[model samples]
Target chain A: MIRVVLLGAGNVAQHLYTALCNQTSVEVIQCYNRKGSKLHPDQKKELVTNTLTELVDADIYILAISDDAIEEVSSNLPFTNRLVVHTSGSVPMDTIHSSNRKGVFYPLQTFSKDKTVDFSTIPFCLEAENEKDYNLLKELGVTLSQKLYKISSQQRNALHVSAVFVNNFTNHLFSIGNDICSDNDIPFEILHPLIRETADKIATMNPDNAQTGPAIRNDHKTINRHIKFLSDTTQKELYQTLTKAIQSKYGKKL
Target chain B: MIRVVLLGAGNVAQHLYTALCNQTSVEVIQCYNRKGSKLHPDQKKELVTNTLTELVDADIYILAISDDAIEEVSSNLPFTNRLVVHTSGSVPMDTIHSSNRKGVFYPLQTFSKDKTVDFSTIPFCLEAENEKDYNLLKELGVTLSQKLYKISSQQRNALHVSAVFVNNFTNHLFSIGNDICSDNDIPFEILHPLIRETADKIATMNPDNAQTGPAIRNDHKTINRHIKFLSDTTQKELYQTLTKAIQSKYGKKL
Candidate 1:
């Protein structure tokens, strides 16, 4: 069994800790965080320490800290020869100390403290410097998740950007839709099924091919009508910009 | 059973036809299209007519034609004081001849020919001139769907705009994500779980509350890195516009 020491008490840390506890092949023996930040109440049974020097002996030290905190915490960690890894998508794995067997164990899925993730379905993106360390990390990932991908730092960076588009940008669009519905006195629940269906369709179909809109059809009358219907200036500008972009992509006149 | 005549053989027509056929209370006695358009081979057994004058007798007539074609077709249909309706979110119900009981039987969901929609779950937006016809249309909607909403033409127009945001705009963002993945030589499927989760989260949480990203956090370092990583001018502009929008909304600076 792999003994794991978790660092930080943030969303990712809590999620990783819970998922580790659920895994039969891995044990979270200890957890460390900055001073005054307590461990999860349920994890009090484990050796939780605020001081880096008090961290328990473990095969792997997993830093689930923020991007800016990686270097600072890695510099202060007690062990130099042990395997050190960080769970970050955008930050490079080597951002941790090179003295240790540096690796990354980034879970590509988003995590919230309140939302329990099904780790079996989550994709673990693994990276390491040496073959042995890489294999160890892969085995750990495979134990926690059904899907494991070996992605380079550069590729992880691209995936992070793409995640922003699909997750962040798409959420903003849903916000816009909710706003439009409220402004018109229509219940936002009416659009929920449609929103779910939109995401479901793209699972099997490419977004470019699944696109359906007045902009794609070049229906200027409908487009102009929608633009006029939008009450907020921000929404109007967004509609205009997106409509133009779609038109240009499809080789249609705006 | 309510005998119905469908006027058009397009995407909306095909979806509505299949949905009606699944219901025990509705019978599509005939389907009418323009002179040369090809009909569905499966629908060959049903009476198909090219001219409106040869329309079959039915209690309800549903015109599932385009917005522009609504007026032309409505002018040609021989109204027998029956309940006449058009399935368009944008077009007003009065666009059909006023000689009959006018109504709108718009299914507020995007329809693609190959995609089979769960009509029982789809929200049917109903509008009619009088109480009797409105109730009749609502009952017909209930026969095919469990969700029914009494929406005016004006409200339906707003919902259409909202649909564009959640459906059209969201799909474009997905396309952008796919493009970024392709350019970076990373498989686009990596972002699928995150995309699905984002949409799923908003179904339970409000979009504004669910928003998370570099823009929301005002992390200029990551934002700048992503901007520099993008290769195309159009994508760079899109990134800038969206980031600026997010920042403006949250009163965060980047």
Candidate 2:
């Protein structure tokens, strides 16, 4: 059995804890949070800790904390010379302290504390210092998901930025759509299917080929009309900036 | 039974043709395109016409052409005083020739000639001058889709603008993600599941509430790191602009 001491009680940490509990071959030896009250209520009191000194021996120690806290928490760990992996896309594996074997087990998905995500569909970006450590991380990754990527620190950094673009920026665009609908007294639900299909299209076709819009078509008349239609300055700015970006990418001149 | 004439030979017109051909109650009496070669290959020669004078009488005429052409084509039609609609999101219903009963039959989804979309999920945004014409358009809408909206020309205009943000801008964001992946030698497929989940999340939750990322979190350190990591000028500009936008939306001072 693979034993793990999970650090942090944030969204990713709780999600990881719940997913690991479902695996028959993996055991979460203990879950650590700065405040014991924040740990998952279902977790047994004996298997949870508020103090770093109380953490027990485990095959892997997964730090699923905030990016800013990662280095500090890893340096403060009581145990050493064991495998310690962080579930951060931005933080490097070397931030896990020199006393332990470093690795990364980043799950490339947006997480909410209240939402239960299906781990099977999430991509687990794994990284380790050696072949054995990589295989160990891969083993744990397979138990939770089939999509495992052995990414280097640099590659993972790039992936993290890309995630911000696709997930965060994409969601912001949806929010703008909602705002526009609200302004016009149109129900936001009307745009949901289009949003769903836009994402689904990319699953089968390249985004470059799948792109269709006034910007790509160089339909300056419609583009200008759209810009003039928007009352909000920021929305207009975003529309013009993104439109220009798409036009520049497609070699369409204004 | 309703007899119809479909105009234009573009993606939307072709999609509407294929969808309408499946209905037992509706018969597409004619397909009109300025260039005969542009008509769908499945359309029978007897039913296809390039000249406006050759257009036969039909219960409803759908000018599924460019926004600029809708006015000219409707005015140039051989017959008058019939239900004439243009399948444009931005174009107002009155853009059609005043001699004919004006209406809008916009299907609010991105269309590609090669991609086969599920018409059942597509939201058909219908508009007309009067109740009888609306019901006629709605009747045809019901044949192809379960979702229909009685949107006004003004509302449809706003919806069209919103569609650009959610579908077009969102797709551009995906292209940026793919570009970033390619730069790092990572397969773009790794981000596909995350992209799907991002869209899926908004289906249940408000995009404002569903938002997550360094920008939403106001993690200036990571944001700066990402901006520094990107070598492309346009990528950096987009990153900064979108980051500021999200931060502004969430009231996170940066």
Candidate 3:
């Protein structure tokens, strides 16, 4: 059996905790948080603790914590030569204390406490200082997701930045769309199918080939009308900038 | 049976043709195109013609053509006083000739000829000058989609602009993510699940509440790192612009 101890108590930590508990071959020896109330719980009192020094013996120490706290927390762990990993995409793996074997078990997904994610399809990006630790990380990741890869800290940093562009920035654009709909007394539900299909199209084709709309076509009349329709100066500037970006990418002179 | 004539042979025209042909109560009497090579065939050769003058008598004429071609095609129709409608989101209703009743039958979905759309869930926005014409447009729209709304020209323009942001801009963001992944030697599929979930989250919650990531949290370090990582000047500018936009929207003084 793989004895595991999960550190931190936020979204990623809680999710990893639940996933680990579900597997018969793994045991979460304990979970620690800086504050007693912050630790995620499902009445699993035997496996919860608040003090950092109270962490018990385990084969793996998974630090699914914030970016800022990773270095400090890993240094404070009162153990040596154990497999210590963090679930961060951008942070380098060497940030873990030199006394322990440093590794990363980054799940390439966004986690929310209330929303249950199906780990089977998520890609687990793993990294380690040595072969044995890498294999161990891979073994645990294989149980959680079917897809696994050995990503370097540099590659993972690129992935994280790309994620911000797709996930975070895309959500912002959607909010802008929602604002336009609500301001015009139109129901936002009307756009759901379109949005879902837009995401699905890329699964089958390259996003460049899947792209459609006025900007790509460079229909100046429609483009100008849309820009004039938007009342907010920021939105107007964004519309102009993104339109120019798309037009340039697609080789449209406009 | 509602006898209808369709004009144009592009993506929207082909989809509408296939949809109308499936209904038991609707008969697409004829479809017109300027070029004979563009027609999609199913042995219904007699109903399609390339000539503008060789049109048949029908209860309604549906001009499912480009926005620029709508006014010209609707004006050249041989029949007079028939209910004529153009399937355009941005085009005004009066673009139709004065000899016929004017209306709009806009299906608010991005259509691809290869992708079969589920018409029942697609939103059809209808508009007309009077009660009788509006009912005629609604009757046809109900046959195509369960979700139907009576939208004016002004409102339709707003919805069109909003669609640009959600569909076009969102797709562009996905492409950028794919580029980053391929550049880093990581498979682009890693970000698919995250993309799907972000879109799904907005279905249940407001996009404002659904927003996450460094910009929303005002984490300047990560944001700065991401901007510096992007080598292209245009993409870097976009990252800064969008990040500032998100920060300002969430009331963070960036």
Candidate 4:
């Protein structure tokens, strides 16, 4: 069985702690956070330490802190040649350089404290300093997730940028949709099915191939009408920029 | 039974044809395409004609052609006081100037020819010239869709802008994500579940409330690292613009 110490009790930390506690082959021996943070029920009996001195010796130390705090916590932790890993997508694996065996156990999915994560389906991107550490990290990842990907720090960083595009920027568009609906006295739910269907189509088709719009057809009349309909300056600018991008990509004029 | 003449053979026309055919109350009296395009298999036996003179008498006429073509086709149609309508989100209801009983029968969802639409769940945005025509259009919309919204031409145009943001622009972000994944040798499919989950969250939570990312957390270190990771000029520009937008929204730099 792999014994692990989890640091930080934020969203990612709570999620990983719960998953580890549920797994038969892994045991979360300790969970650490800044002072005053409560521990999960499962870790009530396990050491829930706030002090840096309480950092326990374990086979694996998983740092689930924020990107900025990773270095601060890593430097403070007592290193014992134990494998130290951080669950960050953008932070390089070397951030936890205090350990002899360092790696990343980054789950490429968002987590909320209330939401249950299906780790078996979540893709875990694993990176390590050496082959032995890589294999161990891969094994730990596979134990938690059915899909494990071996990616370098640089590649993972690219994936992180892409994640922002798909997740963060996409959400902003949805916000724009919601704003439009509210402004027009139309219930935002009217567009829910379309939003869901759009996402579903990409599962089987490439986004470039799945694209359909006035810009794709070079329908400038409708494009102009849409631009006129948008009253917000920021939204209008976004529409113009995206429409131009689409036009250039498809060799069409907007 | 409602006798209907469909006046186009494009994506919207094909989808509407199938949807109308599936309804027991609606009978397609004739199908008209300006170019006399090959009819879909289910529409084969239905009278297919290129000339408007061949059009049979019907209770309603649905012009599901392009926005620019709507006026030209509607002007040429042999209207016999039939409830004439055009299925376009951006086109004004008065585009079909041939009939005083003109209205819009816009299905407010993206329609691909091959993609089967769930008519029962799709929202039909209806607009008409008068109360009597509005009632007729509402009844027809109810037969095909569970949700019938009485929206004005102006409101429909606003919704269309919102649709562009949520659907077209969102899909482009997905394309960027896929490009980044392929460039890094990571399977784009790995991001599918996360993308779906993000959209799913918005169904229950507001997009602003559901937003989570480096920008949301004001993690400039990770954002800077991501900016460096994106090599393409367009992608770098997109990253900067989106990061700035998010930061501006949250009143913090990232």
lDDT of 2 by residue, A125-229 (tens): 999999999999999999999999989999999999999999999999999999999998898999988999999998889999888889998899899999999
> Candidate 1: where are CA atoms >4 Å away?
A36-39, A252-254, B35-46, B252-254
lDDT (tens digit, per residue) of candidate 3 on B158-221: 8899889999999998988898899999898888888988888888989998889999998989
- Name the lDDT value of residue B50 in candidate 3: 91
Q: How many times do residue backbones clash in model 3?
A: 0
Q: Give the per-residue lDDT digits (tens) of candidate 1, residues A119-226.
A: 887888889888899999987888788788889899999989888888988899898888878888998989988898889888899889998889999899999999
Per-residue alpha-carbon lDDT of model 2 for B116-166, expressed as tens digits?
878999899899888999999999999999899999998998899999999
User: Of 1 and 2, which scores higher on TM-score?
Assistant: 2
Scored by lDDT, the top model is: 2
Off by over 4 Å in 3: A37-42, A252-254, B37-39, B252-254
- For each candidate, give its TM-score against the true structure: 0.95, 0.96, 0.96, 0.94
lDDT winner between 1 and 2, please give it: 2
| Interface DockQ per candidate | 0.79, 0.88, 0.84, 0.75
Fnat: each model in turn? 0.77, 0.88, 0.79, 0.75
lDDT tens per residue, model 4, B120-225: 8888899888898888788788888879889998888888888888999899899999989998898998899889988899888988888888887778777887
What value does the lDDT take at residue B253 in candidate 3?
A: 32
